[model samples]
Target: EDDVIWTVLDRVEISDDYTVIFHWKAPFPYGKAMIAISSLINYPYHIYGKWAEKVDPTVPVEEEPNKSLVASLKEFKPPRPITTGPFIFKTATTSELLLVKNPNYWAADTIENWETWFDGVLCRPHMADYNARLNNIMAGEVDLSFITVPKETVDSILTVPGMRFVAPPTASFFDLDFNYDKYPCNILEFRKALAYAIDRRAVQEVAAYYGFPIDKYATGLPKTFEEEWLSPEFLATLETYEYNPQKAEKILRGIGWSRGPDGNWRDAAGKQIKLAITTWGPYQDWVLAADNISHQLTKFGFPTELRPMPPELFYDAWDRGDFHLRVWYVGFWSTLSPWSGYQSTFGWDLTRPESLSWKGRRGLNPKDAVWAAFLVDRLGRAWKPEEQKLIVEKLAELHNKNVPLIPFVQKREYMFQLDGKRVTGWPDPDDPVWDGVTAQGPQCYTTLLVKGILKPVR
Candidate 1:
């Protein structure tokens, strides 16, 4: 005998205390039958205790800082049912995080959650030191980690039981970034001299700590299972700048730089044949390479001052084109196709207004510019039959002359360890699709989730 009531009513305000009165067409208790009337009290004002004083709502959200390694993930707006990975984020405090298994997860049956394996997971990202994380992994306190451990540590870790290594292909290139905008290096011959004066192979073997291989020409123009879209000629232009120490000295002498009484070379303007060598932080391998390069350059009467500083300062000086000689790793990649990364590194992007200073600094030469224009013109539009023909031809020419970029080494990817209980899922060691030279991609964490490697702890 339950019936829902529906009604339309109107009320009017009377006083401060009485507030208002309501009137309805139908009355429940006044049907001539003896009944009790129930009335609900109404209040006029809302009770509040000074409503927590507004303390200037945390500064209006701003865009991410420019030219930084760290980036905001907010812009990506990935599709949902979000990531189909194993783990889902539970809670994230400042110091630590908690990861829980998805109750609705599809793989619960095959993986066996609490029945045989762990129940949940916890992770604390950005752990200050890499070695500390590795030590924890070795002591069985941690299950996994994603820190870049040194090769020495990796060698030691390989001998441990219940542990394995996953070596993934990485997009890293270590080379002398010639500041074509600055003096000495402004002269192509001088740039060529510097290139030939140093032994790239030795530098790669020693400086990288065997972390990467000598790529000789670091361009994303080559085709592999993971990526494609480069023409052969675009790769060939770079080969012309191979190592030649004798030719380096000859080029220096031809530039009116002659050996002086002090066993150093002096230019016709009496400017000492010296280079300002800059490095970021204390990269021992690069420091060693710089030292050796300086030693060899001195043989041709040129002395180099090695200036090592933090990356922030180094990048500041580099962007301003204030460096003499510097070393940095370029993660080249393309957005349209992996091959576009090669052109970006060597072509129009190098000379683009955003990449160069407008205050009188010139970047890539016209020869490089021509190749870049072709790339841009091709990619600027959707694939057309005519454009495709032109792209292939232009790329072949660039590759043949090695016109785009002078690549030297390929970087190796390393991960720091974490506790097994804490680390539940990780990406498989494989070539990254958006590797610097392959694609313009997101960060590691995002990539891991996208690739479906980061599973949850059941």
Candidate 2:
């Protein structure tokens, strides 16, 4: 029922014994490119196929079907695994999951695709406390972590023997999601004013660990996608939200906000309007960015508070829509297209409750014109790139005008520093790897290990 990515279909047609084709209910312009990505089709379904029919619907439907098809995958013990990929899922535990190269792999050593370095791979989940994870790295307990390390420690770590670093604007996007269902913020003029008051460039410099951002601070889409997807007319006509305290104050004044004796703002009722920016912690960059936002807003004569909470409390509060202002990632990953991000963030679909549900955290509703534009874009039946470009341009125009989400950084230039002595030859920027920054180093390592390009230093 949770069909968050709606393009995935329930029905597939087998054209031949070995050939199959997918059928989507709609044109879904991005469907073909994302089908393999957004859905799982490559898994060897025959081995686990037996569980599909075995699932007894008779067992009280209210409770979870006592036995699930997935349960079979879990029952698989160590070493023995039913897989089609180059490696076999070997072992899994609380702290680690291991994968080993398959000797019976279809592409044997004699084949060019069969070349591999490591016989097996071990993966360790980084602890919630980032420092603990870093300590493990320093102590040689963990070989690599693709997550952005403590920014201050990066320089010193780079100087360490056999250590290397790669820092770029990976798919992670940082922005302040406004709760349009809430008060002042719900007002378009007020939101636009807030956008004008804060400077994203300053925030990016302080929050992003990279020496320089890969793209200019964004309004909706990433800088990398701007040339191809964004409409030139939209850029020329849209409000760019450059930092101007005077203009921000002017906009608030037009909205009936008055300056009180305390230099803070008060509504027509004389009640002071305060804004607090809350962000998740355990990552210094998140806190620092929130603090920077707070500082900038304060300069606009708006009182702001920075509440940095632990991830648990932060998410609980976020889900409840309790914060006046929240800064967090808005779901853009390298493997995904921008359209996926826009829909899941603002589309009017009951299946995706987190996007615009009044009771949910994002606080947007179907009233936004952006949702309508997105639907129109999806409706075009033509599959040509020219037709796709026109649709994307329309979507971009509506998105840039509304300012539902303001982004500071969005790119695929993410990198992780690694200890060369432990494992070497990580993927370079030119590598054909499509996966971005992931745990157990970049997903590129997974491919390199199979291709025998990456190796254990010893």
Candidate 3:
């Protein structure tokens, strides 16, 4: 009911003791995903509901200090844990956290093969000194490590006996997002030209920890999930881009950007076309990718600046849509929210008019923002599954034509290597059900594998 109230259900009626019926405002077939998230679970209304406040962006920032509805959500921490998971908190310190398996967990007697393998689990504090942690893992002091490493370091680690490496493609990715409000970037021809001029394959090679295999560069949606989500007719209409300098040059010429006396490209208004690419400095891959893009854009006769700042400053600048072109990643898979598919990240098409915010809290206004917003808003309010797909098809068409963001390389990833001396049966890359992504630990497709799946090789 919590999920449906925003878009689908009109009201929930208490039918009987064990049953509650949801009355939909419209006929909605997309409730399966919302239901899977337990969106109808009742919260403690008597205790916390009083703190709820309507958070509207129209409220002035100065006034928000006192008027925030979520101020209590952050300020208040309950006296004890209140969750129905398999673990129970026991003790904690600056250096460690200890938890014991909830032996009296609700399903203990009724569930099959549901006993926890560990009686207790201890987690060490997150270490900032990555080198020290890596060294300890090499010395067998730590059983596993998940921190990302350089290409050379990854190769060296693979040579360590009793340790194995696994790379899984996560939902995250790096991309080049264009700000529609920015000058030349607002032009479709310019955006498409940049897509063709930049050698994405080369950028992937320099940015990737592992060599950039073709499979690793398929950008945009996960091809594995595409067949399930994208309609065949819509998929067929999608436009694809590849590296072609001549095509880029032709497109730029058609858009009225021409070579000037300085031999650099210039707009009709005589301003030398310049682009700025920024990223957080802590992200080494993004810095390299930005630098690589700067060089490519320069070679294509567009002056470009690369700004690599601390994460805080970079994120603030990104949130303001202050750059002509920025290289970053935006995702829909993580949030799984229909509206956010377009409203998040650079928000190239988000716009607010007539007291209505087209996007989310940020109130981002991008020149290309509203058409996608209109379709997405309808998608949320849509009643029928077929109607929702029709809206998605239109959304896909806008995505291909707008070029708000260009997904260059898929975030093909590597894994946490467990010392073979400590554990085994960490499934390899091609075990079918679990590709080392999605599911975690010894569970494959949520089922515990035989021999515990992850056994102690020792």
Candidate 4:
């Protein structure tokens, strides 16, 4: 029901077999870009059209038709998965998946340079053990790996003959998010103090070798967009939140917190503060960062612990706001717009003006909830860049003042390995297309494949 597409779309009209027209609820400036970059599944109408035809496209989810549609989809399962892409799924196992080229792809003969050269593609599961994946890449058993190579292993991976590494800029980043509804985290001063106590550079060095420390201002936008989207005057007004243990102590003292005999902080009620950061056990970097942070906070007079849970339990905990703190990703979508960044940071879009509760876990204060809804409405209505920029400045200011989440590292580059021995026509490192190959943008190899550029070397 919270599908982003439903926010802007009023209804869809199929004009012909090849064309579909979208009628938006309003003049949404990001409507086109939103659809283009969205990872929405293309469900086959032939199999589900009967159930879909029962629903009124214009009706809300709570109302009739939508709820029925949802129930119908939940029960309906196709006999076989279908795809209209360049490849069709052939087989799958616990460790691997195989896809063969689609002979009936619509653009095969009609479009220029649309031929698919590779007969099939094999995908290996993301091995939790980094060394195992590294060994496969180095041995040339793997043709291409989407895994990010650890910084310590980059030199060794480069030694492999015909090994090509592509480091594309990432749209996401790692952050330490405070559970706003939780105890000490709920206090603004304590949140600020914790922000000042931790070293972002240290976290980046330990967790994300290819990442850059977030800008000191922490305006909720990546440093890359600050110059383009933020005014010089606005940027100067933001708090640096630099690492200062003394300042953190001062803030704690001011807030009626005192250091006990054991060097742990005691709150105004004489209770010792002990916090825990929950992270996904599978994400080695996040686990390391959480451990490092726990040590730093513990040393700074707060007894902190690292609770690394399995992926399933970790996500459940995150969704239920079951932890004091957590290490997670916070950032924008593929587009260069600040709207998505602010949305991700504040979850402004999650709040409806008519509702008292936010849809997501990050419990926002009442005032901020109202402000978030207002900004979301204003941004949706705003079409011009100049108009959108004005609202973004306000969001940045709010985010800076209220430390909802502390961004530690911005993923500057994502490492993916490509074996040139088996595959030819992969983009050269110096190619201009490499610049556009971001984590969210058109992948270089995938772009090459669709354009009929990649071919078997043998």
Candidate 5:
């Protein structure tokens, strides 16, 4: 054997996940985080290996020489443990998943005392079949389900004897995404114009009112809940996006867009000042939003075209930057940085060369500033309290000004009902903190004491 020999590197356990840190005798950042998200069940992951061939930077899949590959395998199909209270993942299949009681589950002993008042707990996570799931719940086939049933359907479902309802807030939002990579929208005035023409209040009343209208909350974070991690100053800064169609029109008119004989706005070149926006087909709400916005934009001389694409094609066009505007949920998750994961939203990192259309989306090219702040925070570089506050405040202002994405609604008091007999240890719906319990709920983990179901018995 050669004088060089492989040696065990460093190892650290983050929560339950084991992370191996291999410090190669040589320099290579390539394999550092390579196996972070391996499909444990079906795929074998190579810790460190050589490329099969030379990789082409321009190509989607570079051909690397003798490269290591990680593949998902059938034998490793055990459900990975989760941390959402008492809902352990048991047997998972393509169509459905069954969750049995973890005999040694942390909650097992805790809930055994509750069994004196009820039966053992069981949880079944159904796939994306809403109608079938709802029918099962109604026919007494299944005990409970999570569904966004329509208003009329809910009235009928509530009539079922054992059924109860829990309305908790959800982390869903609606907003108009400007294709900054393209022309027209590449101009701030165009975005302001489009923003002016839409009637969000009406749209919320019609589309999002499931039963009630979206509450008027600033900062895009819902007022229905609170998070200590969010700074009060930053939350207070969210008021800049208040709806004002009058100002929207003034901004558009100031940009030299004028009304044409045909009753639409035309640019200086007499070309219609219109944009082609696409939304997912059958999303009646988005379609309605498009229509209302289009109608308003036309008044300001900006003609609008609303194109409905099939769900697949709709997302494809968005990723491709083919549309000028889009109406969808702009997800926001609060992490260490105020602008965590914003690179994909505001930065000009496109998969394809043609998609480099949103190049200048981030208003003042604040990438360097935003990213520097992120690194400083992560690296924990020493700085004065005022210095840190200054950096965070500047980052927040830049983020809001860029408007790479807009916020419409924050998570609200949305709830789901379950039959108590089949599903035990279900978080109480009336609990204010319970609304924030599930991942989808407004709160990280609804205030339920679900330590047992979240972690595996292992």
Candidate 6:
């Protein structure tokens, strides 16, 4: 059981062949929203039931099932993919994948005029090369794409005759995360000093041209929900860690730190402070942001280096808490609730041994741990919006006080481009469908395709 679901779910019951019901352990207000966007899939019983039958329900599968049912599941590779959607896998290669429309789709006759306009979808891999993808888009070789275009190139891309750019708000944001177990960063005063020294606006203007600088008093919650869930009076109480190099110098000096003749910060013990910011190399924006931050901190006396690693190595470093500081992406995925954001930030309940081992490795304060547990519990039990708001406010307060993670920018829009000559029914900028087509919303293209809103030009 995943930690997120385990907290709120007691058990699931299959009431009938076509019906399934969930029993919540508490009054989880986000139950419906959670299920709607959950990636949990219903595996075909005929193929998977054989493994399930071997398990002894009385004993834990981890012990009795020596090889472990999970390991077996992981090793079991189906000859082909099985799906119950509008399309079925036709073929795949290193370069491309093809999926043809399902003729016997269950909803074919259920809905009026239900039909897929295109015979199939052909997907090609760009291998994280944005320039190649953009080239394809400009040449009209690609019908649709969700590439991240730099702000300066938007006007040039618009010059393409049949190209259309659709940008919508997303819940995603970039943050600077500190490894709490490491030195210098582990110190609260040092963290605050670094936060004050680094200019978030500079990062936004330089690397995040399409993104907005996070609020000076960010509370772990995305900017979109700040105004909705927090009151003006409560928001005013938070500390705004604005860009102030002088304040940073003062804090470091008060903590018994001094600058060496070489212009590097020396700790009380006379050790020069050297740090590195690790970020994924494939993401151009993240690389630029990390480089910009490293330069700022290096200039501010703490010699910092930008370490750009591949995605796999970067994630491994993050999971193992190996680096001093790193660029992290924080978001609730497809949910707009503050509960998901808080859970992602605080690691839900620290009481859970697994969560403690995985994320609680951050060495959270005991008092903060208690508050986080209370917030998670209270939010789960609060059924009314007003009641949930009160609990969320407290969580935000705690986040504001302790600079657990320094949020840099909030992605306000996602750049999605399409060839208007190939498809005629793309949603306009002001269409209501756009509301459901965000990082925190349903799959927009899938919804449009199923609803017969998009059709190929005849």
Each model's lDDT comes to: 0.49, 0.62, 0.60, 0.74, 0.49, 0.76
Q: Poorest 10 consecutive residues of model 5 by lDDT?
A: 1-10
Better of 1 and 2 by TM-score: 2
* Candidate 6 minimal-lDDT segment of 10 residues: 355-364
- Give stretches of model 4 more than 4 Å off: 15-18, 39-41, 56-66, 110-116, 347-364, 430-432, 439-444
- Tens-digit per-residue lDDT, 312-336, candidate 3: 8888886786777777775444234
Q: lDDT tens digits, residues 1-458, model 1?
A: 01111111222334666454444333322211111111212221232112212212333224223212113222433232243445566777765667666666666566533243444456655533445556666775655554444467677876665465654445445666666666666565665566666666666555555455443443333323113344455444444445677787797789787767897767768877667777765455556655655566666567877777766888898877676777755543323233334333533444456544322222345555555555644543434645554564455455334322234455554443332344446444454532421232224454344344554444
Per-candidate TM vs. native? 0.59, 0.79, 0.71, 0.90, 0.62, 0.92
Question: For residue 164, what is the lDDT in candidate 5?
Answer: 73
How much is 381 displaced in model 6, in angstroms?
A: 2.0
Tens-digit lDDT track for model 4 on 344-458? 5554554454245432434457788668657866777798888888988887787788777888887755545455676877766667676565534434555667776676755
Candidate 5 structure quality by residue, lDDT tens digits, 1-458:
11111211122223534643445433322122222211112222341112222333343432332121212221233347543344445666665666543444455555534433222234444334456666777776655455544456677788876677776655445666777777777676665545445665666654455523333322222333224233676667553545676776677678786667786766667677657777766555566666666665655566668887777888788778787777776333322222223323433323445333345434334454446335333322323555544554544455455555554544233344544444445545676655343333312432232432222111
Candidate 3: which stretches are off by over 4 Å? 1-30, 35-71, 79-82, 89-152, 209-220, 226-239, 260-263, 334-393, 432-436, 439-452, 455-458
Model 3 accuracy (lDDT, Cα): 0.60
lDDT of 1 at 407: 42
lDDT comparison, 4 vs 5, better candidate? 4
The TM-score of predicted model 5 comes to: 0.62
Off by over 4 Å in 2: 1-3, 7-10, 13-17, 41-51, 54-116, 136-143, 149-152, 209-219, 231-234, 309-312, 332-336, 350-382, 411-413, 417-420, 427-443
Worst 10 residues of 3 by lDDT: 355-364
lDDT (0-100) at residue 214 of candidate 2? 22
Give the number of the best model, judged by TM-score: 6
- Per-residue lDDT for 216 in model 6? 81
Cα lDDT of candidate 6 equals: 0.76
Return whichever of 1 and 3 wins on TM-score. 3
User: By the lDDT metric, which is better: model 2 or model 4?
Assistant: 4
